[model samples]
Target: MKTNTEVVTAAVVGLSGWDALVERYSRLVWSVPRSFRLSHTDAADVYQCTWLSLAEHLHRLRDPEALAAWLVRTATRQSINVLRLRGREVPPDRWEPESTLPTPEDVAIGSDRARRLWAALTTLNERCQRLLRIAAHSPELSYAQVADALGMKVGSVGSTRSRCLAALRVKLEASR
Candidate 1:
């Protein structure tokens, strides 16, 4: 059996790689909505949305090497849109706790905490706030996406996010 890398090279170069396509990327697709800490209702909706986005846009992806990253980006973008449509305020520059598919009560708790945290987040700077929120919301986000979003190298996303989260925590606790 051809491995994922082999298939990717085949796909990227525009050869026969359909079997490997499904095998390598199905899990990546499934993991999209799961990456968000969504409510059950929201998860299902997000899953459907992610698949629809993939269906609509997958063919436009020229770089087969970016298949997984593309799926994740689609899922995240769809999830964000769903949250916004639900009347939540989604900060364009940072992830919001209220963006998840949570019950009102859960949203209330998270929002209250996040409101305080956001205030602190602002103190740290926009970049720190963005990184910390992404880390908090999507533990599964790949370094490539993080790097793209933050304009950093893929390999550095994890360490940069960690430091940002630590700084946010300190600011949050100090505000309490």
Candidate 2:
């Protein structure tokens, strides 16, 4: 497998690595808008827009290795833009219901243990929730990318993650 840096370098030179870039970052990109609780359609738009943004600026990217961070930042901004646009709409009651069907991920995690873990996750503060979600959903992300995405110092990522996991453990233990 090509490293992210290699993929990015290839992309900068030609189109061959574009698919790899998209494949590598798609989940990380999708996770951002989902984290905002945007509707599916809105999330899809954010996802596309994020990729488009990357495509438009690919050659100019200062550090190709920071692609994950760039994607995260772009997706976050797009998600926020979507929320702001939705806020301007006059008819709040016309909102479509979110899908009731279980996503593949939902089915995969459908177990007593997973349910309990999710319940415990919900009890965490917003920062912890966001941090853990990003970390969990994109295990390939570097500490630098995670820190850039979260606007945290890179040095603090490991410590904060440890503390957050400890808190989650406490919550899980309490529930038992």
TM-score of each: 0.37, 0.51
Q: What is the lDDT of residue 141 in candidate 2?
A: 96
How many steric overlaps are in each model, in order?
1, 0
Tens-digit per-residue lDDT, 48-147, candidate 1 = 7766665565556566556677768877887777767766655576765665668889989888897997788889877877787787788788878888
Colliding pairs, model 2: none
Runs off by more than 4 Å, candidate 2:
92-176
Could you give the C-alpha RMSD of every candidate to the true structure, in order shown?
22.2, 24.1
Q: Which candidate's TM-score is highest?
A: 2
**Local error of candidate 1 at residue 97 (angstroms):** 30
Report the C-alpha lDDT of model 2 over 37-144, residue by residue, as the tens digit. Answer: 999999999999999998889878888878899999999999999999989897857775678677888787677678899999999998899999998899999999
Reference-based lDDT, each prediction: 0.73, 0.91
